[model samples]
Target: MPGLAASVNTPFYQQHWQQIHLPLLKQRQTELWVCHLQCRVPAIAGNKWLKLKYHIQHIQQYEKTGILTFGGAFSNHLAAVAAAGKAFGFQTHAIVRHDGAVLNPTLAACQEQDMQLSFVSPQQYRQRQQSGYLATLQQQFPDWLLVPEGGTSPLGVKGVAELQLNNTPAGAADLICCATGSGGTVAGLALGHPQTAVLGINVVKDPSLPEQITALAPHQHNWQLAADCSGLRYGQFDAATLQLCLQLSQQDLPLEPVYTGKALQTLLAALREGHIKTGQRLVFFHTGGLQGLDGMLQRQRITQEQYQQIKSAELRLWHQFG
Candidate 1:
């Protein structure tokens, strides 16, 4: 309850853009509205807070000591759980997929939040979803609530469903879009706004994701998934996507390349390809993971100039809204 209370008090803002110089959107006569969820704990911004808040409430209700979760070395989910734990007074532990010998900026941030980390081989990490493996984890950490990777469980979906993304400044959005990694956010949107269509740009190549989303919101049929346009691996992004993120930042929208940028790129591509129809309002949830830019910079996935450009935009937006 303390965690939920703390997060509920944080300010949230929405920025709508209809004047971008994109010919595709103009030709389609579509408007894009972005909901930027600002959290007191920066890492828990955007969908992270929406996904994790109910999990924290559940642990508190059941009198659990803390949370034990799984993620890759630079996972935004892990960073979010760590920050939420620190902000709300819960112990945190993570089973991380091994990426390299050293800690990246994301992992370093997790440690700063006092999140206990245990690295595992990729093969072992894949077993996280198995019932037997989950049983073992429960036996090992009996007092901690075991949250699914990316917080994609029912509780996570429930938390995300509380968002009112359909109600834009002008009117209700005809379509709601988000970058779907684990499917929880899109599922929540579909469940929350049964009248509006929800399109999730699948950032990962996992074939089972659609099925996973269906399982999460079985009665909801208003949602669909589209593959990422880049055709690159989940963590790997192309230069064009990076360029789009930079361009949008100048318009006062700070987007990171991994999820938000790739999603907007795919959405714009859909508009160009005539997949999205004309004269509709679209609300894209800027599910924040801008902190991952630091990890990207540390791994040389982005240049110093690119990092500074994005960071400067983020600082400006935060100064105005945060």
Candidate 2:
């Protein structure tokens, strides 16, 4: 873990998962234990760290020159890559969607981390896996290890499976829930905690999300998905969604709508729908995406005031309601 080496500024610890008992959960029959991975490291924290852990090691194993990965405008994955590259001595390249040289906060931060920016149109990025497309990139960036979008390789799965919960009050979790983007996080969780039933909240409406999870990690213990909780579609957020994000942020679980926020919303909705039975202990994985908030505000997915409110919530306190 050279990236998270014993540096004074490293917010992440060797112990990746921290169990926090929300005061609100005690009121209900169901118990909620949140594993806060969002603030795992000073930068490049959260579930992305779990996803990219082995990839970085792969780069070291192969003695690769650099890493090239794919992402959207405000991709937390790319930001994590940039941060990781900075901490480690590897070059980073991002094949991002949107055909512009705009130095948005995310991209700018990547640039600061010395990640080379490569802009591709949405259509071209969509064809990223189409035979000649990848071949061309291989030819152009020879010697570069191309990490798949969201860094969801088998090695990545192996890396994420290493993340375990500590300080478990009553031991194992009855249910583990996470936001499903590329299905890597849930796949890793399923593989790691086979005894626990895992639920994935679809942040991106992919009809084939389950299939993707199956492909990444073949398992039979339990892999369930909860859909229609992403505020209509991917990268879109509503006022209520923003409010929930703020609420969670005030509780020390900062999240953005693209990933973590949607998962929380889905969990609450599941509770309301009676999907979560009483007396069951739930462990929710807080996949980080604080870097995406600026992009969300810029795109008007969330208002400026809403973002500010989330940032300035020191006075807000959590109260348990019965």
Question: What is candidate 1's lDDT per residue for 1-322, written digit by digit as tens?
Answer: 2444445434432433333456667788888777777776778888998788778888877889999999998899999999888878889999999976498899999999999999999999999899999998999999999999999999999988888876677888888899999999999989999999999999987899989999999999999999999999999999999999999888778889899999999998998888999898888888988988998998898999989999998888777763
Per-prediction TM-score: 0.94, 0.87
For model 2, residues 1-322, the per-residue Cα lDDT tens digits are 4644324233343433334455445545777777754434446666877877777777777788889999887788899999888776789999999756367888888899999988889998987657788888889989888888888878778777777742456677888888888888888888888778889888788777788789888755577888846457887767677678787766655667767777887787777667788777788877767778777677666778877776554123111210
> Which pairs of residues collide in model 2?
12-40
Summed backbone clashes in each candidate are 0, 1
Q: Compute the lDDT for candidate 1.
A: 0.87
How does model 2 score by TM-score? 0.87
What would you estimate as the lDDT of candidate 2?
A: 0.74
